[model samples]
Target: MTRDKILVVGANGELGQALLRELGTEKAIAATRTANTPHVGFDHVRIGSDGNLPVATLKRCAAVINAAGSVAGDDQTLRSANIHLPRVIALAAKNAGVPRLIQVSSFSILGAAEYIDRTTKERPINAYGRSKAAAERLLLESSSDELSVECVRLPFLFSATKPGLLAPLLSLTTRLRYLPTVAGNPVRRSMVVYADAAKQLVAAAQSGLSGISFVADPRPFDYALLATILAEEADINIRILQVPRPIAASIDHLLPALGRRLLRSSLLDPCANRVGDEPLGLEEELRKLVRSTYGS
Candidate 1:
């Protein structure tokens, strides 16, 4: 094993795989509790639990990239994976004297946890978001002074493997052709391609930056605008169904519990919606997603 080892947690995941791809040919370890299939050159190690992460895994690692997240796992499982895992990883890294840690966190951490009622605040309406938010806090409050941790709060991540924000919404609209545009559901929003998000993460890891970075498309894109693009580019035709704002939020609140999870993620998910208003740009890099996904 090379002295400069990078351990990528959740290497089997879409973003994790992308991050490994970005690392390309570097001496790295890919870990997952799930069975690992072929993924580039790295060997897969099964960590059934966060506490089960092998010490030898950390012994030779120079940096640990935590791309681990649980979307549908049990509440305890999700909490263990998201919150407990990061803390354990940080502690391990600190003990091993690793220099940097790159944690992939969710954009939802910035939600109105303080302002909105806990019941209504969109901190994380689903198991996935809650896990990520808790994990983000763990990473933030990590006790490892030796670990230079970089937490990236990411918006919707797009890739061929997993549907991005636009693709899922577009998929839902494909059959219906029309979607209700509610007052609160901001049509324009910011998102990032999985590849690009991975690239930025790798870059940040290489740069040795120790802080939080908000990663997303540098432009405001609305669902209406996105729907139009998909219809034109992907050749899916749909109508815009305008629903009331309160109804949309209400629907967002009840859908998961009722098992009627939105076919397309809620545009009203508090964190995802606020990204549109942040200071971002229409960089040349972002236009590539349009071409790649929608075609020229």
Candidate 2:
């Protein structure tokens, strides 16, 4: 229980686990819903949903990163994860003498938009979005010098975990060698891979970054570029099929009800340089992913 530790909530999650690895066991103590032995080199503390995070768990922590959140579930579940949990964590962190709390939020807070800039505000078009936005508002209202709070709007991530959009897109590369370059697809959008996003979270927690900000890869990509990287790297053409931009975009429209939205080439902006000077390394990262996941 060193006083310099960081308590990472939801340490079992994709981003949370990455953060734990990035921060290392020496500085990180995992705070999870239930005690478990999954993470080998670190420590774990129970953070129950009772809105009562054990103060002792955070006592030694200089900061807390709320990687715990829900994107899909019933109304109660969403509200609990996105809203209640965050508010509770903030209170616990402040009380425990933790100096900073970095909350994990989603870009869904900006619901339907083709292009977004600094001027865009939260106009959530869905329940999940609304829930996340509400959580953010709660944190902002409570922020103070004693326990500075910051919410990071993490976008659809691309990683080996195959986060929502990447799962389908990466599926296409396992079996296809020849991919098409489409009109809408030079679509550089606001998205980042998991490891990069985790690093940004670490930076935010360490700096006690103020206000709400967005995170994304410094580089941009679309169907052809991503697909080529996978096919060339994996050398195994087995499982995914990428459609052209117009076709993919149309599919996105046709299934608005689908929980996982397809990656539309619509220009999604994550606010430039919000992630500082980290190189996105999209090509190399994807190549490694292909080898690890689909390569022989």
Candidate 3:
């Protein structure tokens, strides 16, 4: 029996590679820009310079994963990958009778609302987020019965392959036995590891789940617990020193910028509907991430 074919755009990218691993070659066809991409021998769909994808092949796809995007680039590059490409894919998918189109987005689109929900309007702080917000709007507008377009607005996604914010901090684990964090850090934000995000995206494709969806652990995330996990995974002392406010302030500059940013209060409301699930909780995901990155 023939299995469902999922077309993964940006097949050479971090998330695209993750999705390829999740779906495997038998089920997924990687969409690359040129035949000369790193993926030399795989089922390929070469998107054109004009943002035109071959609609004929798209007709056979059960789902199209619009994973092509740029996290950092010039304005034209961001618009091309994050906005125009998605619009082009959406129109083509609509015409090709594709059942689902899963577009990758970012939580940055909403900026730092004290608590973000579906009702929250996008107020991106950076060019990347702005591009994503625009892309999401275009995709959602293109959604219809024939083509269900759902943009997975990812938060702090990490993995061994793409360590993201975790790389520098995790490296510090080797130098410092215990990380000194602000005591009673209560900030909770959406987060997902790369593998899980890929799995969740595949599920969304199969289920034809549509609309804008924020992603990550739906439960309360504890910074102290996360610090411990990072320490252990990095093969350092698994002690998280929760320094008091007065003490923390004396050396708060020691904290990495990303670390300070994370400790700040910004959470997605628990009631807000999101896509990815963290059945094993955020701690386990962190464990998986560090282990993968360190090859431990």
Candidate 4:
């Protein structure tokens, strides 16, 4: 029997590239805005011009995976990339007779929820979160017998190739002998290794499960533990100074921008802390990332 063709949108991104690596080049069709050169070790099609998706290409795939997102765009750009793009893909996939649509969504949509699961309601607090929530809504509402949609909500993802949030944290911790943090250093948050997340994404695409599912590391860690682990691995000594949360909250209240940033930080206010069955170990995954990136 012949294998079904899978289309991956935003095939040039970190998650997209990871998915391609997991799924292999033979079974996947890479779609991006520009097909000028090879992408993720595969030839790709320029699926969109400006802001519109290529309906013709979408109609030909057996399944579609949307890994595209806008992390730091203005209101209009955010809406277009996060909301409009996914909406278009869902409609085109439905029209094209595509059976499965896997949307790589974010944990930001859940905001500061302590324990996030499929049943947890979305309470987006920022523009990016709102846009992602809106996109997820559109895709879930658009699901049908012909087109099954699944949204995989992911936490902070890290890899050697893409350090992501870890890079900054590592830099800050390594440079300072003493790091000051809010009182919530023990607040654990969900995280996943990029390679592990890719496996889950591929499983979701092939499993034919519908609705929302969260993929995360088996264990959650707080800022203090994270700093200690990094310091020990890097062979450095650092002290963590915990300030009062009330003082930090007061400062945040005085400065709106800082308040927003603080609210978004997983260390200060975690969104997800639940674990799944046979999940990856947090320390093991962190060690892999550190070894790959820093060779320690």
Candidate 5:
């Protein structure tokens, strides 16, 4: 019997590579912009950053997982990758009769939508968030019941492979004039270990789960609490200041351009903060992140 063919766009990406490992030993095509080391169950294809994917090969695949994304530039490369690439994939999948397509999106889009003006609303205040939001919208608009198109809006992701949210925050702690104060807001957010997110993603693909789903930390906490935990692991003490929402919002506007410089590619671009509205086990995941980053 022929095994199902899974194609992973951006297969060389941090998340894509991890997801490839999780899928393990499947008949899959891993697409990247440059040559990469081959994995056991997959064949590597060097694709252009532009949407010049192998259409014929794509058609034969059973599912397509798009992890390709970008942020930065007067180029608006994000529009092509985040918006056009997915649309092309969807259309190709439809023609090829592929059953499902999973697009990875950012939680920031959800956060910034209500707060920012419409002109830049869809376009993230930060470059990265704009890319992700555009990609998510493209996926949603292109999908229908006939094809199983699902968007996985991920929050802050953590893993040993790279220093994530905690890294910069920990760095910030060192420079603080004083320990920041904890805020009382029960803001919802979700995060997942890269390995865990990969496992769930591959499993969901194989299981053929439909509709939109979010994989996040089962719990969420405010920044102050997060800093405290990091400080504990790092063997330092810290405090937090609770900036009121009005002040926070004002800052978000005043520093619109500051986002690209500070955030780069993170979900924490305060302008595009998409804290989860649903329950997510963020604390437990943070513990894992701390262990991985600081060592158990």
Candidate 6:
């Protein structure tokens, strides 16, 4: 009997690569815009310039996991990748009779919600968030008896292979004697290790549930605690300085570009809190991240 093929779009991306590693090469096919990518030794499909999945390729797969996304891009680029591409894929999957379509979405759509669940209303504050929210809406709305569509919303992800948002924090802790933070050290936002998140995405695809599902680490650490954990693990000491939120917000407003960058860093102020299965705790996650970046 032939094993069902799983086509992973944006297979070269961090989440896409994680899925490839989790699903293994035998059952997975990598789809990207360009054939030349770091992910080698796997079957690859090239996405067309028109942003449509090839029908022939779609028919050969059991399911299509769209991990394609962009955190940094202009409005047009964001919409094309985050919104248009997913819609195109959904339509193609339905037409090809693909049984399952899992879209990897982000927590950015939650905006400043303190707690997020399956029923939380999305309030996107920026172009990236807006695009993702729109994509999720489009895909979920398009689901029918013939096609199974679901969106797995993920929080900040870190892993040995992908440092993600941790890279900047690691740099700051090691380089700076003092790290500035909001006046009140806010609780750390929700996050999941890459491997765990990858497994969750695969599980969501296999499950029969439809609509939005969130995946995150069970326990979240605040900024100071996270820095302390990293510092201890790395054998480096750094001081934490608290700055007023209004002042920070003012600075951000004054320098719009810089503020946007900082907000993405998750260093500004905690907006939404994430809740999910925590296979690995904060310390363990930070330890793995530090080992990957600094070497034990």
RMSD of each: 5.7, 3.6, 3.7, 3.6, 5.7, 3.8
Instruction: Give candidate 2's TM-score.
Output: 0.84
81: Cα error in model 5, Å: 1.6
Candidate 5, residue 142: the lDDT equals: 69
Model 5's number of clashes is 19
Residues 71-181, model 5: lDDT tens digits: 455546767767788787777777766778888776666544322211233334466676676666667776766568877766667664465555776566556724332
Instruction: Tell me the TM-score of model 6.
Output: 0.83
Tens-place lDDT per residue, model 4, 1-296, is 23276788888788888778877877777888875523545646776655445666566567888988888879999999999989888887787778899999888898866566556778987899999999988899998899999988888887655767667666776777555567754446667877788778888888778988777876664566666776767766777767688877776679855543333344312232223456575667676666665677
Report how far off residue 186 is in candidate 2 (Å).
3.4
Estimated TM-score for each candidate: 0.72, 0.84, 0.82, 0.84, 0.73, 0.83
The CA lDDT at 173 in model 3 is 52
Candidate 4 off by > 4 Å: 1-3, 37-43, 50-60, 179-185, 251-275, 281-285, 288-295
Ranking by TM-score: 2, 4, 6, 3, 5, 1
- Candidate 3, after superposition: displacement of residue 265 in Å? 4.4
What is candidate 2's lDDT per residue for 227-256, written digit by digit as tens?
566557755443224456667656567875
Q: What residue runs in model 5 are displaced by over 4 Å at the alpha carbon?
A: 1-3, 38-41, 48-50, 113-131, 144-146, 177-189, 207-211, 221-228, 242-296
Candidate 1 off by > 4 Å? 1-3, 34-37, 48-52, 111-122, 143-145, 164-168, 183-186, 234-296
Please report the TM-score between candidate 1 and the true structure.
Answer: 0.72
Model 2 pairs whose backbones collide: 171-240, 172-240, 172-241, 174-238, 175-237, 175-238
Per-residue accuracy of model 1 over 63-142 as CA lDDT, tens digit each: 88888877667888888778888888788778777778888887565442322211343356567787776776677677
lDDT of candidate 5 at residue 140, scale 0 to 100: 73
